[model samples]
Target: MPQRSSTFNPHDPVTLQRMQSARSIHSEIMGCQLRKKKVLELLPPFGAGKDYPPQPPDIETYIVEFDGADDPMHPQNWTVRKKLRVMTVLGFATFVVAWGSSIFSPAIFVISEVFHISTVTAILAISLYVLGFASGPLVWGPLSELYGRRPPTLISTFTSAVFHMGVARSDDLASIMICRFFAGFFGASCLAVVPASFADIFGNKTRGMAIAIFATCVFIGPLIAPVVGGFIVTSYLGWRWTAYLTSIMGFSSFALVVYFMDETYPPQVLVEKAQFLRRETDNWCILARQEQSKFELSDLLEHNISRPLKMLFTEPILFLITLYTAFIYGILYLLLEAYPIIFYEGYGMAFQISELPYLGVVVGQIFGGAMVVAFEPMTYKRIVANGGRPIPEIRLIPTMIGSMLFTIGMFWLTWSGAYHRHVHWIVPTISGIFTGMGLISIFLSALNYIVESYLMFAASAVAANTFLRSGFGAGFPLFAGAMFKNLGVQWAGTLIGCIALILVPVPVLFYLYGKRLRTMSNYAPT
Candidate 1:
């Protein structure tokens, strides 16, 4: 009855309040609808099949996404200065983790003497640390996907630093082994996640150059570590200083990361934005597509935990690439032991001086990276010519070349250093340049190819690669002493070189058939 009075109610507080509330509710509902529309338009279609179970029909949902292509929040749209700062911090983090892997090499003798363990047992410190690398990526990879790059990187690196400190203070072999393994496990985060972060920020055209820089940091870390660790071990500061030094570097990296790093993962960013919008609007329906599904332990296990393993086994591109990278990584670690045999013992060089040869490998890595960077413009032109879509095979060119160089270096180092001891020491040491160049070239190319091929799944693909390579890395050094000692450096080196030669065609095969394989893959972009 009162509704019949449609006029003369301007001064009535009750009527005005009711009318204002109605308008406010209508505005909120319209706003949500418009937002949902914008989100759908901006987002790529989820395709026919749904990844998550359907939401209840009765509930209205508003998805949150980047505003548009120019959305500054997008990682790709971040300012070059900020991206470079982030890259530098990440590069350092990666370098520190890698450095930690081999720093213990120089301390092996000291550890053997102090702990009254065999040289082989003393080597466990390095082996276990690398083994940790194998396992850490399994968890870190999934966590990076579920959370974001920054959190996993910070947590793992900081924890690794703590473990390094644990190794530093440990008095017993058991304690040392545990600490070293855990340190490596935590340190593996940088290996598993940094490449993905690089991919997140850099577009395909420039990603190769970024990955090349990353590869240099990676390979150079181990190359430089022994030099530093050797001096530290031979000093009054003692072998423990090696672990302490790594811990210091780790902490420094963590500090830098805390100061400079921002979330680069686009999905995670959108999820955070959605959470912020929900808080501001007091609307529970505002959700990121990533947030649409309720968190379940089963989903996490099935999707995040198992996906990399599944992809690793199922995808040929991933498997072969991982295998090749793993072999190269293994050889790199094996050289940690082999170099000492050839230089320190065989060549009768001082322990401190033997470590210097690693610098040759470092130089080679720099050249390799430079080569990849140099090729980026040509690749970019190809990308442009192909209508702005990158062909993953184009990345394999360097790998093909590097494979031959790696094989050559392997033979040169082993034969000259082992068989022709009278040959100048520089002969063997200089060979490191080729090995280093080949190592970095193959590594950089494989990584760029993986990132381009898998796109959104780059993290998992990389994790799979890391898992296999770290396994190789962990195992190689354990056998290096015996293999080089028994097989003689020449035969041992020849064996590895032969393997490298056999694998030479891997990149070539992929380069020729990669497109077809990608088209056939479930994980790779068609």
Candidate 2:
């Protein structure tokens, strides 16, 4: 075997970054190693493929290529079925976290009455929990980079289950608020880590579908919560069961994660491999990133925290899409505020029966999943036909149509509410479905685009999306009731719809200018 030597400076983020970049070279060279067993192999040239355009030019200097591109330890070399199984476990973990966020929304009044707080303040249980969702990612995203994704994910998720149990048992307002926030904070791991895991496992060709499936599962969690939460509220068990049952579900998610998930982050896997090889062959030259870089907490924190923000500001494509996604996310959470008003206040339905309206959003999520199934392949085919280089803009095509549908659905709900007696309840309920589809379409597009554009930095880009959107998710509901109460349902919805309509230009601008935008950034592909 041939050996090479270079000065090792552990703790350099640039060197750490190059360690990650080496995996692509390793993956690209997979099968070629068989023919070159006795020769020095050149690094794999990147770009003009569904994989990212390539890491920074310097990454090739610090690392060894894998034995071949098909090396089984490399996640990209995993079978499709194995890749998806990891996604499934991660997706299920996500479902319970989101379920905890929204399931208790319908019971806010009950919680208020029990705790003797105002209904407005009671709504903070939901919003504060979402605030935790936003903030947790800021911490967890960096933690995952320091540790691998799995430890932080498992630890956070398991503790989130404990917090949910605390939420169930809380007798005072402060207790519930504190417990819910912690629960959201811990529960955020699945959201923060899993998409990055997806990117780690799949190449660009299939990442869209992976995100779509995980996102579909995520969308379903909140929408379906009202169905079960409503029954718990109306039943003798009362509102606390919403948290109690969700806590139990969180525990179940914990077990699924511990049993099924193995480390998928490529750099971590390589570190383990390097360790094993060193012990086996007594070859200290088998270097992985962890061995090459000294761990520096302050540098890690600064780089992880500031780099995403830096990329966020400099990259116009990321800014536009993330802002759009943040609004769409906020609106989705805002619906938790809107739905009970429409059904309970407007139609005078019982709590359990009123939840039937949320089924509309569930139906819309399904339709959105189907749209991805239908349209994603078309998008993929176009990328393939373009000689394998995927344009980040391809993600925006569905988003354009989604923006229009979202606007129409918002208007439909607004106008239909004024004539509820003249029109069947089904009319406005279907509006939820259309709006749900619009929401999901925009979500999937933006998420896939972020994954495509940022590539390795996806966790950070997504964290930025989560921060702004989750803030909106948290803040919007604080005012949701006020808007509907003061303006009435029709005009309040019009207020929202008009904003969405104005932002409709977001996708159009990106689609036309994405390439030009990428040109301005060192991060985005040309």
Candidate 3:
């Protein structure tokens, strides 16, 4: 104390060293706070940030330096295990969403009876559900990109569950129908968010598996939902159980999402941190470029709002694939509605037993999922063998094989039902298996090619496809009753098969000339 000197230099080496260390610590603390802010926003509650400072350059520096993964913040660079967990959870959420939409189809009769309504109006529930699916994704897909995947997903799912509960409790058809539409509107959140999420987590090489898993579930969900719902309704539980069961599934999915799924949207994560840093440090400069743009809200809304229509109009590959997929989906839905009428009413198969025919679509979907999984590794190997660059046409190999079987399934199911043959019904059921397999295979390939050709706008492109696909899915059933009534199952299915036959060459054409077409087109991703 007595040796203390007033003349002491603050720039003395010891003092300077301490000062430097203090600044360094302060900067680090600031960064940690920023990162924690992002972690809270981007990750669910369980993945809270540890105290350790991020061991890299600033967020922007890392974003650029690591090329993409530097953003240790990126959901894409999330450890393989973490990413897989997210996909599984999100995939299941997707399952529940589609499950809710179609779970009530077979229960339509029960609903009709309960509401004392015409069968046609009861079926409105199904159509309105699909209609919600058709429209909701247009907004949700882009919004998730702007906001994080979590908030929209949680909100939508929770809202959907609440609405589904309403559907269960409603006493009248109009109330139920309104509730059903909103339920689907909320659930459609899963579809819009899942694909974009997959693109966020997986890279080009392994995306096929991610896509396969997701697309397989989306396609199979409806098929399985009706099967389970049919059994539930026929088991004396009644149609309302369909709504309750779906709500339970949805709530369970929400729990899983809250636990497992992390934010995959890059912009949202950055903006989250930007928001925190700006608030805490009171330094506006702390905001990231994306956050600094005051137009973000408007841009986000516009991007989400415009994408579906934009992709539909601008991209030929997206347009064509959407058209093709729409027809396939439409027919699939039509068959879902008509099968009960044809096999149960006309052929006298018991409702419970008649559902066994759906085993065909289920079997086919399993095969299709396998084909897609198999196709991916094979294509990757071939590309690696051929000096590492993949040809767009390579994707068509599975499509080619699947389409043939698809055509066969259509003919088999159509004619077998039309002739009213007593061949154990397993014949058409097996055909359904093949059709499902083929349809999914082709669908995966088509979607992959479209996304590859439209990376930045993949959400929009998919939105366009979903719009058409669900539109057709919703409307197709309405026509099924009339078509079968006038044309009979054989001619009706044959007519659809003839259309599919026309479509068979589309993939082949794309396979052979796809690259050339994408290369020449203005917006086809070249």
Candidate 4:
């Protein structure tokens, strides 16, 4: 081989070609920056000595980007303690709002007696409260997208507290119902936003556990509320104290959130970061959240409100899951109506003793939540590791299990609670465990499936879920007394159980055909 020459030629074609390639890359990178307005701090400095020299332009770029995996600004990269704090606040807030709904169940009879209204009329408070849950998400979900999660969370929680206090102070039934509805409407912010917040911070592996925990609190709150409310209603403090208690709890939670929870929405954080960078670096090219910041009131109503409704009707998967979840939710509240009459008339128990039966459901939910937390993540991680994508079908397995349990539980509750043959109350209450197990398992699975499938439109998908389930939850109580009275406990419960049996095939069919359905879907993640 000839000896290599040490001198480099300045006019070499190869060197010229390399220079041209570098310029191309530089232009593409600059174009990316201008289009997204993202500050890509990871890029090499454009200096004379740099290998891929930046092209000379009117403005020099020193865009701020996340520092690899260690960027502190990234919510996922925050300290584990910080993530836990966020979870705690969100979980507690969800519990408080849920409690606000059912705490009034024990008070319903009291309100009826005081106002000389019928039982069904009194139940409108609970029903309307749940209706607020359904409606609020249509508005709040989009607001979270438009603003930051933190602002929506704080504003909603504070307004809910104010309304809770309004309920406490109200003297008339109309005023109480109005206050309760508005309280629930505002407090539903957590239902709409917190799940997405978890998605913002957690990877698939950890999100399963987080969802299980959050969902447990949600299911458990309403279950436990009757117990607490039962005691409060009978106490010297009376029914209004329940609202006062909720107000105090809500306000306390609001303060905790204000102090601890930082903004978690990635786009919002990026926008703030861009604003800071623009101020620091004096660059006008960075435009953080330009699109979101421009949304006006009309735009918010149309996109956030109308879009979810459109999706609700148009998206088949969302529609089916919502219907299924709503049916189970309706039955759960129906049980509340059925339980009071059964215990009061059959066992001669006061409202406090009657509410004791709800604990069984609470225990079952805890069991269901624990099971989901324990094993689902292991299997989910295994599936992902074995070359499977995070398909929505992964969640359907639990829904099947839950549906079967729900069916059995309803029939069991029928035999134990509705029968004329004298049976101990513990038997029916024990059956409530199955009800909780099935209800919560289905809820967790469906929720996880929706979020995983609708990653891009998770908020809108959740709004649909909220709308249907809460709608059922609200209406079911109104008619539950009538159903139980007309059909008797056995047939009434059997009817619900039969419906649940029919729906068992839903998740099963979805498990088999979900991918194909997703292929046809406009919103589902491919």
Candidate 5:
């Protein structure tokens, strides 16, 4: 047996407890006396109790190559001003992407006239932009993981802006359609990038509020675009000016991003820095062992590209929520399209006056946005109290109320219009306010919960949701007029309302069984 000190040194504590009874006494003695001593001496000297150097505490504390701050790649340590600027740039870019959905609302008649296309076909142009929104995120979501956010954002914004410029100068329907499609393709990049940007900028505790703010901006953009477009179109600025204005907004957003946006992708930044350090010092060991070895480009490509699609296909929570969201989004666009015909044709109103109905959408969004911000923290607290399992279903409270309001509003508006009741045009408009408010609340709550449930893959989850939603947004408007004409106003709205009603239980069910549901779900984060 080998003898050992019974007492431990506080400053240089023994790592191994017993060497002999541990079955490796001789080897341990050699290691401690010879190998360990040599290794300790080879390491830099540790501090004594007194006369300490004024070095950074982190430097002396951690044995890694650098403290977190020393790594310039960490986004958290960035200046507050710099972070805010990046957020602003992303927010503006998001606004541009969202604006595309409603910018053409006032220009529908103009589009019909210029293209000599039927009203339904012309409406598809609006749908196509949203379709681009739906699909763009999936492509961009994967690409960002592969290439980093900056490249995709830059390329998408620049290209989308250029397409809008082309739209402004387009001669015929073919050119305009081509420009719009390209614009949507580029515009979709922002949708993919914005939420990811939020994830990078805000901590988990504060992220929900930040996301709500982003959602507010996103929702507000579409609502306000129509109002702006109405004035632009009514002023004889021509529908092309709408494209021009949106292009200008996109360009300004691009410049802000170029100047302010710092790289938030840790892997990409570290990889780049590692390559630089390897070049400068020619030391392969400069980075931590975990990051020293580069991953295979093929593996990264496969994972990045395939993962979102895999999750989209496999995740039941993501799939169902996406379906519901798409239906909601479709109904929204359907309602937008319906407003023109419902209020103007059915009631006999002027074009500028007809655009006033959009006020309902705006007012509703304001109310919903406020409610989300106010109620979310309470819900979060309640869920925590119920155990750590916060179910996605609880979020349905707002959605259910909103959906019922949506249906009632639609029914009331339709019946009022059909009967030529005592109410002025404002009556239906007021009902529209209720519908818009309810729809936005439900849509936003569903989206927020999905994002939370799929935190690891938030962009991809949202992309899937956006795809379904945008598909509806694009397709619904095309049938709005025909549906109204064929089914009659009351029945058309009632049918859509009934469809919305079926989804009411979805949120409630999820709220109760969400933990179990998420447990069974493959795509949901554990």
Candidate 6:
């Protein structure tokens, strides 16, 4: 019957009307199916009902997405210069927050003298700031996912600057502690969100180098802080200037972000585009798929707040990597205490001079970053060979190498500093290079691995990692003095080294079995 109709004239009114009506219906059905597919793509695979409620069938929905693979509005398609501008702002924000964590560390003694508190109690200035890091991520990570990177960054950074101002203006220890903790609470937004931002702008081919640069900033900030803080504390500017300077930097970061940073998260970008489209077309039905989902407080608590902790416990890869990185992070902070003991007390160096040794670690971090950058071509080759799919385990190779270097550095510093009276101060300081390289390598690898493995859920994974690592960082300094004094530099360092040695197999095991683990994971891409 259709074949018979094909011979009919095109100009026949009934035939033309019927054909146009059929085409219209077919177009509407296809459009509906396409929108449905996109909505499904946006919804969380598990518990989609709880997270994103189903839209009523009576409503016609228009889902907005990138124009195509080459959409200029997409972060992935942004010019290199634009991405770097955003990254520069984010990286500086990360550095400022990390620098804030330890800048006050050099002022502990001054704080103790002013407040008539023990050095141990004064250490709370740093500890509380780091502890704030742990709590801040729980809020910032979810908010970033909900609202996008820019809002949380601006709000938190500005608030953090105000709190830093409060710390600068405080007259009492209680006020200072409160201000410091809140500053960190806000500042931790950078730590929790920046890595995810990096993942957004950089693809798999170049992400390792980008993350290496990020990890270098993270590891080097505290190291650099003691150096800068030592100068600030020892100078006529005094300890308050430490807070003042950090505040200035924080404010600067806020300004840069406000002026330079564009929203990078794809879903949030689509939401903005959808809003613009709705305005132009006067069609309220047009919406980003993410906008269709109602944001419930209960859903936020269940998915955003609790999910990271739940993943920490349930995911072997996340838990082990978090544990491994946390321990290294703790030792890094512990060195804030241990370095002074080793160099200042043992070798009779001045406080500021003792802080100079941290530069060795800084140099090592540079080397570690170079190492990661150098490996990028090889990784790209492997990715091409594997038909464009990246292997998460390949990221762990540097981690394995870093683990051994970490252990080696620990023992080297332990023995050299144990004989501080006999050994040249340079001996122990030289160990910092190895420690720094190892630290950067391990941290960079872990971060990239998690991002690659988890894909969309990277922010939550990083928040979990940050939570544990900050806990260790905050706790380690409190016991560092006692441990170094009681166990002696040699034994205490040996203890840390042995633990590091135990964790050395983590990357290796993951490298071998990561695919299997990822295949079984509920959240990670298989």
| Candidate with maximal lDDT | 1
lDDT of each: 0.85, 0.79, 0.74, 0.79, 0.70, 0.84
The candidate, 4 or 5, that scores higher on TM-score is 4
Residue-level lDDT of model 4, residues 1-526, one tens digit each, is 3333343444654334323432432332122232223435546576887677454363224333343344567676778899999999998998999889899899988999999999889999999889999999888876676566899899989999999999999999999999989998998888878887877676566777787777887788888998999999999999999999999999998999999998886656666887877676676566443222333455446555676788889888888888888888777778778888677666678769888988988888888777667667665776578454466677777788888888898899877887535888888889888889998999998888888777535777787788889999999898888888898888888888888888889999888988887888876647
On TM-score, the stronger of 3 and 6 is 6
Q: Give the per-residue lDDT of model 2 (tens digit) for 1-526.
A: 4544534455554345445565542332121222343332644645566563444456434444344444566787788788777888899898899888999987898877877889889999999999998888877765665567889789987999999999888878899999999999888877768888898887657888888887887678888998889888989998989999999998988898898888887767777787777787785566665445532455555566555566667777777787888888888888887877887778888878888888888888788767866777788888888766667788888898889889989989878976667877888998987898898888988888887776666677777777777888899889999998899989999998999999998889898888887888765544
Model 6 over residues 85-130: C-alpha lDDT tens digits?
A: 9988999999999999998988999999999999999999999999
The per-prediction CA RMSD against the true structure, in angstroms, equals 11.6, 10.2, 11.2, 9.7, 11.8, 10.0
Off by over 4 Å in 6: 1-61
Best by TM-score: 6
Superior by lDDT: candidate 1 or candidate 6: 1
Model 5 lDDT per residue over 78-103, tens place = 66687778888888888887887788
Residue 310 lDDT in candidate 1? 86
Q: What 10-residue stretch in candidate 5 is worst by lDDT?
A: 13-22
TM-score, per-candidate, Cα-based: 0.88, 0.87, 0.83, 0.86, 0.80, 0.88
Clashes of each: 0, 8, 7, 1, 5, 0
The sequence of per-residue lDDT tens digits that candidate 1 reaches over residues 204-297 is: 6778878887888889999899999889889899988999989999999999999999998777887788898878778777876555444456
Model 3 poorest ten-residue lDDT run? 62-71
Candidate 3 TM-score, C-alpha based: 0.83
Q: Residue 29 CA error for candidate 6 (Å)?
A: 27
Between candidates 4 and 6, name the one with more favorable TM-score: 6
How far in Å is the alpha carbon of 507 misplaced in model 5? 0.3
TM-score of 1: 0.88
Model 2: lDDT to the true structure: 0.79
